[model samples]
Target: MTDSTKPTVLIVGGGIGGVALGMLLHKAGVPFEIYERATTVKPLGTAMNFNATTAVMMKQCGVYDEFMAVAKPFSAVQVGNTHRTIDYKIDFSEQEELFGAKGFIISRPDIYDLLVRQVPKEHFHLGKKVISSEQTNEGVILRFSDGTTAEGHILVGADGAYSSIRQHMYDQLKKEGRLPATDGEPLPFSSLCLVGQTKSLDPSVFPSLALDESQVMTVLIKDTPYACSIFTTKKNTVAWAVGEILDENRSKEGEKNEEWGPGAAEAMCQLSRDFPVISGGEKPLTMGDLIDWTDKDYITKVMLEEKVFETWYDGRIVLLGDACHKINPAGGAGATNAVHDAVTIANWIHALPPNPTKQEIESYFEEYKKERLPKAKEAYDSSRMFKSISSKSYLGWIAAVCFKHMPSWMNRTLLSSMMAYRPTVSFLPDAEDKGTVKPAHQHSLETRRILKERQEAATTAAVKA
Candidate 1:
């Protein structure tokens, strides 16, 4: 392409990450187009939590204020045993004082809408699934399942988990004898999730809900399944997701087929039986009583992990969001992390010297991988550990017991760490000194020392073992 011709960036999957990246690129005056396999965007999934980091990025992209207006913030998170409230609670007031911003809870579609509104309709081509793409010294060529073809300066595999682009890239490498094949492990925890909307909550009941409008409330039960319910918008509508740990082997191979389908409603009913909010369980819980057995299967296939890929980029093609790292909905990091990936990548691209060379583009991706890989792995491991701690087994019970008695300060510290986490990116200039706002407070020297000591201790323990 000539210098007069704007270099096109092809983005696959029009989800939150894809759209957010597109909007950022558009604002930076970069040429790009997004192709979504779906014919139209729908508010399909449940609720998500947005940490201060994600909220700040959204604000920079011009949707933070409007998005905040629609979401409700939970000022405190509660954990309980049977009917007794545990002392463990995340104090949002303290977090706000530390981070200088508040978190948000919003519907998946609300974020999608915010991103779509910023992009030109003509730039988006729906129903076009990417089949494969190849890169050359000049640019990249992409083929769609619809039999159309497009050429661009770069291709992004933001297609999400089960991404055809990722699969194709793997296939290409395998054909050239580059990678090894092995059985993929199922997630240690899997659950049947039921999600739907309900009427707005009474303010008198949930006084601690933070979202000005959309608030997510997660309640970790002592002996029963984990249940969470939250409002997604200012409208009186709420969405809830209930997870029950199942036999991983039985659940994956469909051995427990009878347990699914209609069993979803039964699952919620079981929640009421095991832990009744009226009897001191989490409050404002009505799904068990209001939902009908025939409530049309809203449950989706269980996920092993929020993310499926270990690496997110290859040559000129790259993956982001759900395509790269899928997080469990429990911690509300899924959507937030995805948006962070978009902003991070956009910033990396912006920081590139003017008219970067092909080797520089490749080097940029290398730096991206180095910076994001550890953070992605840490987030993934944290989610898995949290899920295991909330399961319905003997060990899970023991964990709950231990958690219940743990110091409230310890719990608060951990919760804050999860919310305030910022992935270490090697390429970006010092974000703070550069005048770019950060989501959390700067890491203290004491905290850094503690982290280093912990890393050393763990390394030594592993070596000894």
Candidate 2:
């Protein structure tokens, strides 16, 4: 049963981030309903890498063990050229020893399914395309395309890059001249990506499929506009992607924007099919082989864009995940960052006062943004840096060389900064800090402790009276 004192949360969009937040809120005993525009969930995209940044929260939610089952361990990435010559390797083997958590790679849909099961079926509503949203002193309301309405105390826009909720919020803010000029601008994308996963292959055919650790092999052809890569999965399948780095102006002017769907990927797949891959097999492979092995219905093409919004919350409506920040996937941190946002947002909501006032709710939102904004920017910067290094330009070459030969101390410092921010739900027994490097300060955890102490003291005095 829900405590009437706690605010009921309405989350828009049923992506991984939204579902993740729903799971946390459920575990914390808070009421939340997730609304997705699509009637059925079609798990798209390739795969994602999750490390200490989110493993602690998964454990707190009691899903870490299942997550481990669905995911393959990730240790290092082998980068090379189309000629099959090794360039450099990005090592992650030290992550576990330094951060006290192992990194894993899992198919996007597999993890989504795991998280979705944690929430009750009734709480996750589908076919609810939210057209617009409005909030008042009493609560917030969402009007769907089908003319139905739902009300809740808090509204969270977890929609993707082209978020309708964000457009509506900006529309209102723009009319009042409160929205930043940058926020009103359209999202710009430069790179086009084709992502898909092959069916489970024979271990004899692909030797790497038998390994415990997911082997990531990437090939960057010199002076070419494309980068192709493949990853081994725990299920004996291989996930692959081909990214075409386009000139920003050229892409915006000449190319038709590619939407993320099945048929949309065919064109890009054809263009990159001939690109070479360094799969650890008896013979060399090409992107075409993997493309042919993958089911056409599961492939998707999308335009990669990066942006961090200035306004995350106004009134009772707040935004999380891709709705607020869209980062390139080149750094493999986009999903991790989204998961981090969900964790922080859930923490704040869980710590809220019973029947929180509008001012109090907004204050919590403010704190959530304050804690996540810098981290989002850091991820954004790291993504762009990685994207640049993966490109075929002269600058990309220089960046890659520098990274390959970076001093050990410098490399450790950089890795530490990115890996030291593990946060758990404040409502649960926090995950033990086992890393040699202590985690960064968490505002929500500190706030929850103080609030708990105050409530206990008040209860003692009332009992004595």
Candidate 3:
């Protein structure tokens, strides 16, 4: 295809989704540019858990090897009360053996760096925030905050939760009287999460911690002020996130702004004093003993009620990732689902006929929506449910106690479904199928072969030494 005929995708936001999408399109021989709102692509948040689906996409983007170079692998997930062991520990090694791939816990910047390295420097324009976009019969026009304009065949609102492109699309649809009515009240879960990170703990003392350089470790302290602590180790640096559920209504209405309000450290400390965990073979557990409370800083995020837009596509512009669906981070599925959107879109666009018409593009967008919306909703609902289950008062405590005694197989089964989810589009054959979907195992086999080769080479090097 000539330069003029090449399909151009204008991706908003330089976060994980946008950059990963750009990398996929580039690998597919498609021309695209990622316009990031940030002045520079720096590490934005703490760590993120990359399940199997996203790991497959990262592998396809040719950055899986790069990720393996720096990321740590999670062998098991431990969940229990502060004082005693829980039966809910999940050992992913066998599952990884079964699936032929392992999950990774890496810093957000590590994945971003891998993607940015694959993309051509010229194609990524930093500090170019998209202000508005206009769809035409031929293509779409994007106007940016820097007072510049660029036209492309399609525009992707990978800009994230507060997407300007999505707003613009909704406004245009409303003007044409095609928008859907607002759904009832937002999600009922009103809680704020304080996310923060700290210096790596000494592995000798915190032997239970997964400091494997790539594994993500989650500690659920029952009947404690701290609801959960999610930590992922990356090289010498270890990233941690602590979340305290808050009253969402009060935070939203601007009633409470204290750094340590109702569900702050002090409250957690009080809870710890009430329910002591038997640690180091001792009694009367303290908050300082459980976590490094003094050294860590926390960022408070009031969990907004979950809001799913009535629609994700308008004419030629479409929403991807957090732009269309916002899920609670209780399950760490938001980032994974967002990355899946990027891959799904790229695969759909690649499957279209060469030099397709505008109608063809719209059709592709429709198919993309039909396939992805359910999966996005599933992740959203699962996050809400998990949060509800985790935060129940008395009944929740009973269930949590029961979960501690559940069989290992049951817990593994539950987590496997979430961690191994692959979009429907990823399994399609390239111009050679009768449309029957391939089993997920086939893809797992491919991943296994690659991983095995890398392992063998490592073993050989070690033996030589």
Candidate 4:
């Protein structure tokens, strides 16, 4: 258990970023607590994709073994027209080789569960909704919807896109007239996505489809607002989807949003039953199979949103993940980037001295922003580009040819160059250790001492063995 007297971090949101940050702080011997709005951390989403960069970080965190055991690792992505007129595939084997890691596709809840279990129950507070925050020279205080308050040495907003912490931070900045020109813009949406995972289907049903192989296949309808991406796992199931941006999918403006729960799951199933996702081999696999196999509770519908905020921090409060930069799911950076932020931000916090002054805290946050903002922009740009290139435009056509129709060897060289640039966790043993941006006088001496002792113990045990 964390000592109450120790310097503590209050992490808002209980998703991937919040839990991962708690886990890392625990490793650094830092006291921290996670506050989440959800009463229970159930499997919340359908499917998730992984690339080499994220894979390496997961391995470093010691969750790779378990993640791999449950996920389907894919080495390529296949894009084709729904009519089977044009079929193309991009092989990622060489890219995986370059990054020293393979890619994976897994159920979102399965991965979420794995991350949650690593953080102790004592560190988390479920059913707690953070509404606002106030900070002074000493530390920060959080105000919850239930009229309760939480005081901590630092406040990190790992909340999602509709982050209350972010809104509070922005409000404070504007009140100070530091951001008189900024706009809290809403995300623009061009497409709607319906996602769900079905019970394991027989690979024999779709000839040429190999079970247990790692790969992504996408079906696009030309000249129409329709597309579906499927990730097949050896676990006897497929995560599939059919998406469109029709008016029927959009919510009326100025209306409060209530979650479209599992009751809407059946609606998606009905719409997808006859929609074909892949027309390969003698028999085409239609969305009907997926809808029929998946439970009503597993389907989800959402308007895909992508954006990056210009400001990320103010005083003792800072932002991470979707709170600051929301990304399209095309590149699968959504969850990976969130976890990466947790580690990077934890590193900066780990460098902070006990009872740090306001100036010291602000400076460290500035340093954190310097390292992260560019990476967030890159993800935002890439995800936006991916969304566009998945369409029927000339650029999309060129991408399909260059990515899928190209030779296998050429494909590896082309994709790996892009894959290798992805951002990863910064605190792993093999990770690049750029020590705190703060001066040596403000360094985390206790953290350094503990880290040294751990290193020495490992050496001693090895020598004794």
Candidate that would win on lDDT:
2
Clash count for candidate 4 is: 5
Runs in model 1 deviating more than 4 A are 1-6, 80-90, 180-189, 199-233, 254-285, 288-308, 353-357, 398-412, 419-465
lDDT of 1 at 260: 53
Q: Please give the ranking of all candidate structures by TM-score, highest first, separated by commas.
A: 2, 4, 3, 1
Query: Pick by TM-score: which candidate is best?
Result: 2
- Candidate 3: the clashing residue pairs are 71-214, 72-213, 72-214, 72-215, 83-277, 83-278, 225-268
**Cα lDDT, model 4, residue 65:** 87
Clash tally, candidates in order: 14, 0, 7, 5
Candidate 2, 285: how far from true, in Å? 1.3
**Model 2, span 1-465: residue lDDT tens:** 239798999999889889989988888888899999999888677888888788888887778889998899988777888788778877777788778788898988898999889989999999999988998998999999999999999999999988888888899999999999999877777688889999989977778888889988778867678888777888888898888777967566423543444456776777787888776665877888898899988888777777999999987888988899999988888888888888888888887887888998899999999999999999998888778866877878887887788777777687788888887688888776578888888777766776778689879999999
lDDT of 4 at 86: 44
Superpose all Cα atoms of candidate 3 onto the true structure and report the RMSD in Å to 1 decimal.
Answer: 10.0
Per residue, candidate 4 scores C-alpha lDDT tens digits across 148-261 of 999988889998888888888888777877763544666555566788887766667654346457547777866666777777765756777776643334524312234355
TM-score of each: 0.77, 0.96, 0.77, 0.84
- lDDT for model 1, please: 0.60
Q: Candidates' lDDT values, in order?
A: 0.60, 0.85, 0.63, 0.71
Q: Give me the displacement of residue 358 in model 1, in angstroms.
A: 4.0
Higher-scoring candidate on lDDT, 1 or 4: 4
Model 4 clashing residue pairs (backbone): 73-214, 74-214, 200-236, 200-237, 201-236
Model 1 deviation from native, Cα RMSD in Å: 9.9
